[model samples]
Target: MSQETLFTKIINREIPADIVYEDELSLAFKDINPQAPFHVLIIPKKPIATINDIALDDRELVGHLYYVAKQLATEHGFSDEGYRVVMNCNENAGQTVFHIHLHMLAGKMLGWPPYTDNAKT
Candidate 1:
């Protein structure tokens, strides 16, 4: 069998996380290394390596992930103020964890393009 991803461990209760929201189909938790004042991760109970790996049959599960993110934004008092939901697809997109997850960031305005290095500009 393949090794369990860190998120899977959290889902199975093998590891602890600062979980904020959870349902039968999904889990939401604070990011260990947050990029914004309010950064959370929403993941599915069933492990899918990345967005590219999501199967057609998993549509409901994937859609529920977004719903959970939206609910969390409201619950955390940031929905109307504005927030961002991001999903990194692969290594090139900065997806350190293989599991499919959505990043919910808010609490402040985010930079545009997400890259500001003059050298890269």
Candidate 2:
């Protein structure tokens, strides 16, 4: 068994988080370090480590994560205009937390290829 990650602790209620949404299989909360005007993280209650660790039986749960993200975006009043759901993979993808989670970003138009020096344009 892999070690319990930070997200696991949050899901277990061992730590406090600014929870926004929760269901039998998922949880959504505000990101401590906001990347956008409205930044929220939607994660499965199950500790699946990372996307690569997702099992075949977890397909539905993974789908539920996106569902929750969409629901939250609508609740946050941004679904109509637009929003972005992002999931970082491994270290190369800037995944500091190993747990599987989706970032729902909205409230403004986001730039493409976030973190670029604008040299590409």
Candidate 3:
């Protein structure tokens, strides 16, 4: 069996989180480290360790995560302003927690190339 990831801990309520939304298939919550004014982390309740681990049957669940992101943006009153959804794959991509999660970022205009590549100003 695989090890339980940090997200599984959150899903099981083993650790405390500023939960924002929850449903049968997924959960949404405020990120401990906010990247945007309106930042949220939406994750599947099922423990899928990484994006590469997602099975064929998980397509709907994955799509639901994005749907939840849309719902949250509208509920938080930022849908009209737009938002960004991101998923990191592995260490090189900055996937800190093993379990897959989608980041919902908004409340301010975001820049392209979200990260820097050591470019000069």
Best-to-worst TM-score order? 3, 2, 1
What digit string (tens of lDDT, one per residue) describes model 1 on residues 1-121? 2358999999999999999988899999999888789999999999899888888999999999988988888888998999999888877777888889998999999988874543210
Overall local distance difference test of candidate 2: 0.86
What tens digits encode model 3's per-residue C-alpha lDDT throughout 1-121? 2678777888889998899999999999999888799888999988888899999999999999999998998899988989999998877778888778998999888999987763211
Reference-based TM-score of each model: 0.91, 0.92, 0.92
Shift in Å, residue 19, candidate 2: 0.2
Q: Which candidate leads in TM-score?
A: 3
lDDT of each: 0.86, 0.86, 0.87
Clashing pairs in 1: none
Per residue, candidate 2 scores C-alpha lDDT tens digits across 1-121 of 4678888999999999999999999999899988789998998888877889999999999999998988887788998999999988877777888888998889988988775542210
Selected candidate, larger TM-score, 1 vs 2? 2
Q: What TM-score does prediction 1 earn?
A: 0.91
Task: Give the higher-lDDT candidate: 1 or 2.
Answer: 1
